[model samples]
Target chain A: MKNQAYRMALLYDFYGEMLTDRQKEFYDLYYNEDLSLTEIAENYHMSRQGVRDAIVRAEAVLTELEDKTGLIRRFQERQKELRQLQELASAAQAANADPVVGDYLRRIQGLCEQLKQE
Target chain B: MKNQAYRMALLYDFYGEMLTDRQKEFYDLYYNEDLSLTEIAENYHMSRQGVRDAIVRAEAVLTELEDKTGLIRRFQERQKELRQLQELASAAQAANADPVVGDYLRRIQGLCEQLKQE
Candidate 1:
């Protein structure tokens, strides 16, 4: 549940460019910069309700893009799958596999790390 | 170069639902059904140019979606990386890794195959 915010942040990363300038600013302030609605309103010389509405609109756009493309869902799925692959590779390497086989398994683990980061 | 058509098909898989029904029909006819513009036009009682235009518009929509989200490109990258992982795992198993390690390596290869299919 705590990662829900992280997912929203990732959605913004994928689709924030499509949002209007004002929405983008307010969303970054509230979500990334961790500013309260009142703080964003004061800084932007807008009402708190306006800031809230803009962020909500940005969220809607991001969610809609994700729904249409399912990119974020696929990304998370890949990450989960990669983690499983990494675990298996690590287990194999720890089992005293042959030196050559260990080297290959190590390479596999490295790729899983890199792919997960991507 | 030949895979260019395959890439477009993958893009359509991700974004074709966003296209209009007509565009989707023409695109499917031209690409998936391997129908020529003339054949699709004859079947739909439209001009060849109309069928071509619809397919192009559908292509533009799919291309835009991919450009905005980079989902298809990312998917391709992951598939390529997983293929590499599969190769590594196969090499490890073939190198006479410990039987237990071989089992794990086999599972990793299986996951790579499954993920690439996804």
Candidate 2:
């Protein structure tokens, strides 16, 4: 659906607690539950504008934290590097690597994949 | 000094930007530079308690971010696992692995050590 969930997951995973508890509640409903802003406003008994302001402020906090820390960016970068390394291992194995050694390279490629999931 | 710098470097590297500009400045001197709190307070022209509060709050933010995301912890865990995998590679090499395969295992060990430093 190309929803914001993927980005939200990245941002919220990194800095969700930066939001106030109240803000987090609304954020979960809006992003995680895919609830409409008006639905959230109705449920929370707040003005739509008030609900939106809280969400907007929360989103800003998430974005600002990301810009400042760059943790998520670095993480994604490391993942990219790991995948590249796996490819390199495959190349190394193909380049006249001994069969036993080729086995070791395959194991390493597996490890790199494991690291990426972490 | 077994001081907070090592811890700070990890925290800052992971989530330093969550701090206010003022908080980051003070945190650098206190943790990164190992300045006494009194010195920091004097330099910043703030009350001692004010300086302390700022640093404490900043530390809390870093710690909380780590706890919630588990990114740093997961990072450390991966490093550990990589090292262990390297050991497994060595074992594979020792158990009658071809000489060329042994070289690959050695190279993988080196890579694991490199990853730990990151």
Per-candidate clash tally:
0, 0
Quick one: best TM-score, which candidate?
1
Q: Write the per-residue lDDT of candidate 1 for residues B1-118, one digit (tens) a residue.
A: 1236887788888877778888888777777888889998999899988877787777787887777767777777877888888888777777873678768877888889888877
lDDT of prediction 2: 0.77
- Which ranges of candidate 1 are over 4 A from the true structure? A1-4, B1-4, B35-53
The candidate scoring highest on lDDT is 1
Segments in model 2 whose C-alpha atoms lie over 4 Å from true places: A1-5, A93-99, B1-5, B44-49, B85-118
Kindly report which residue pairs in candidate 1 clash with one another.
none
> What DockQ does candidate 2 have relative to the true complex?
0.37
Overlapping backbone residue pairs in candidate 1 total: 0
Q: What is the alpha-carbon interface RMSD for each candidate?
A: 1.4, 3.6
A1-118: candidate 2 lDDT, tens digit per residue? 1166798778887789778999999998888888888899999898999988998888888888888877788888777667656765665566534566556667777888888888
